[model samples]
Structure formats: structure tokens, C-alpha cells
Target: MIENRNEFLSKIAKQLGRPQPTSRPERNFSFSPQHQVLANATQEELVDALVEQCKNIHTKAITTTTADLVATLKQVVTDYKATSVITSTDQRFADFGVLPLITEHWPQQEVATHQWQERCGQDNITFAERADVGIMVSEMTLAESGTAVLFSDKDKGRSISFLPQNSIILIPKSTIVPRMTQAATTISAMIERGEQVASCVNFITGPSNSADIEMILVVGVHGPIKMAYIIIEDQ
Candidate 1:
């Protein structure tokens, strides 16, 4: 196999009238003009752009103040008539008083949270799959693509965001960046600082959709059918 592979490569090189380089090529690591523009965007501009872009992709973006977040979430639960809900175990969500609001507004609803110490195993999966709403706190959000970054670990399970029919992401306005590059830089900095990054970083732009069959667009084929982002401006 080695001989055959070398011969094939030699033949290709001969056809091109040149020898194949044996060293890694130099890469130009410069930002594009579009990226530069996004990089320089102000926070208010990023928030506005994110909301508009999110809507373009069929995702709902709702801005709320820290004091009004509980009220906003209540409205969301009532609107969806959600009877089963799952929430990430991130302390920020708890600090934002999401758990108490859930209990107060939907006392009869089934609730399961991603546990930091113990993997609930099949029980967690069942709850997530059957959940009418899944609430997650994003690590960061990108304005250019209207994407939310979810770093999955023991405390924030991947299924908590993907398995539910509907997803509600609680994004702190402070974490909103102008583009993917900025978000990537933050993750890289974390790694450089010896932080334990999650095994999987999911970049969700919108609810799962595809235009594969007959070029007809369909939503929620593989993930949530409905998605809503609640951006907490005060947080």
C-alpha cells in the first residue's frame, strides 16, 4: 500500500511538473474585512445585530432586564404550555433565580436538572427527551451568526439542549461577543489559563433544520422544533 500510494503521488507530481513539498505551508492568520468589522462592533450593536440575525434564521430572541427575567420566563412557559422542563445545573442560572421561578410558575410540571456530581444516566435522558422545554445557560453568544455556545460537561449535559422539543437559552448580555473569532479567542484563553474545557463545545445557530429532500426546507428534523433565546441585559 505504501509503494502504491508513493507511486500515485509521484505520478500526480510528474503531471504537475513539480515535486510535492515535504514541509507545512506557511499560513496567513489575518482577519478578513468582515471579521474586522464585527470585531470592532460595540456591545449594543452586537446585541441588535444578534437579535436581527437570529430572527432571520427563525430563532426567537427576547431581551429582558435582570429584574424582568423571571417574568419573561413565566411568559415563555405559559405561551408554550410546557408541562415538563429540564434546566442546566450552571450556578449562573440559579443565581438568576430560574429554578424558583419554574417552581413558582409551573408547580405541577416535571423538572429534571443536569447534575454536576452524578450522571443520572438513563433517567436524565428520559427526562430530557420528554421535556416540553429545555433551559440552558450559554457560555457565550456570537452576534455575526446568532450562535450560542454550549460547552457540555458534567454540569451541563448535551442532551439538555438537543433532546428536548423546545429549547430556551438564558444568555447573559455580557457574554455576547461580536463574532465567532471573539468567542474562539475566549475559549483559547481559558485553555491557556489551564481551565478544564468541556469535551464538546456545541455551536447552535438555530433549531435543527434541513433542506435535503426535494429542496424543501424543514425545521426541527433532528433537534428542537422551537427555540427561544432570552438575553438578560442586566446580568
Candidate 2:
């Protein structure tokens, strides 16, 4: 029994001499400029390519002045089957005449208003989930990359962009910049100027896609099936 105990203690002491487990250093992941699809396209070419892609998906691409965008959105909303619930964070959307057409979901609690985040999820499962499409307004868009950057503000939350089956973005042409670096610089400048940094800055290019499952390409797995960007220019 003494010999057995001694052997057990010796084994335990030997095992303790092994190397301690260590954690990996956190990596700074980044997008490579060399592989960025829209890094160098001219404005005309970028817009044309985007419009072509939009047409392939049966989406309407309309160019309007900032003044007319609101009126145009009203017309679009009027023609489409009006949803029981519509949600957005942009007050500029109010200028478009879409605010009255769809129920406004706010982030804050009013006398009767439910929280926007909760309403957004519920709307997704109930309205957006059942319906074919939903719409979101972008903070800014990068014309060079054909990317829509959505950030959380007073009215908009990130959940609205991520939880829906389909997402249509209304990007004002004025916000269209030539490059991502310029966009980042602008945002950082804004941050320095005391603008509250948003909880998330989602730079979306087209729709969510994956080629992970058996190396088969699939769209809309993580997000929308159809993603459309209407670059509303003040032409």
C-alpha cells in the first residue's frame, strides 16, 4: 500500500512538471486592399456595375435628387404591399414620407412605443420573416467598394440590418465616397469632433453568403437572400 501510494504521488509530481497551457495572442484581422473587389472602380463603372447587378435580381435602380428621393420613396412604398410594421432609425426617412406609411419602431420607450430592438426582432419573425423584403437606410455608402455602411444612431440599431430575411438600402448619393480609407478617416474625424461612436459600423457588400458547407456556395445563410442598394443621386 505504501509503495502504491508512493508510485501515485510520483506520477502526480511527474505530471505537474509538464508545460503550462498558454493562450494565443489576439490577432488584428484586416481586409487586404489587393483582394478588395471595389477598391479601384471608377464612379461611373461602379454605379453601372451595381445597376446591372440590381437588374439581374429584378430590383429597380432609380436616380433622384436628394429633394426627390423622399417623394420617390413615397411612391415606391405606395406601390408595394404596405407592411403592418416598418422600422427605421433615420429621421431623414421621415423627410421621405415613408414614416407615416409604416409604423415607427423606436429604440426608446414612449407611452405606448415598444423598444426598437425588441420590435425589430418580433417584426422580423412576424412581418419581415413572413414577407419577402424589408428596408433600411444607410449612414453612408462607399461608391468605390459598392458597400453600404450602417451605423447605430438615435433611431437605427444593428439588429434591424442583421435579423431580416431581405434588406433594401436607401443610400443618398451625397454620402457616396471614393474609397474606404476616406470613409474611415471621415468617421474617425467625426469621432474626434465629439460625435458618439456607434455600437456597430456594418460595412455590407451585397448579401450574406458562404461557401463553407461542402464547399457549396450559398446565399442568405447568415442574413438576407436578396440585398439591394438604391444609390439615390441628386441628379
TM-score for all predictions?
Answer: 0.83, 0.61
Error of 1 at 199 (Å): 0.6
Model 2 misses residue 34 by how many Å? 9.2
* Clash count, predicted structure 2: 3
For residue 149, model 2's alpha carbon misses the true position, in angstroms, by 0.3
How do the residues 112-147 of candidate 2 rate in per-residue lDDT, one tens digit apiece? 112244445555345434443456777777654567
Q: Which pairs clash (backbone N, Cα, C closer than 3 Å) in model 2?
A: 65-234, 89-155, 89-156
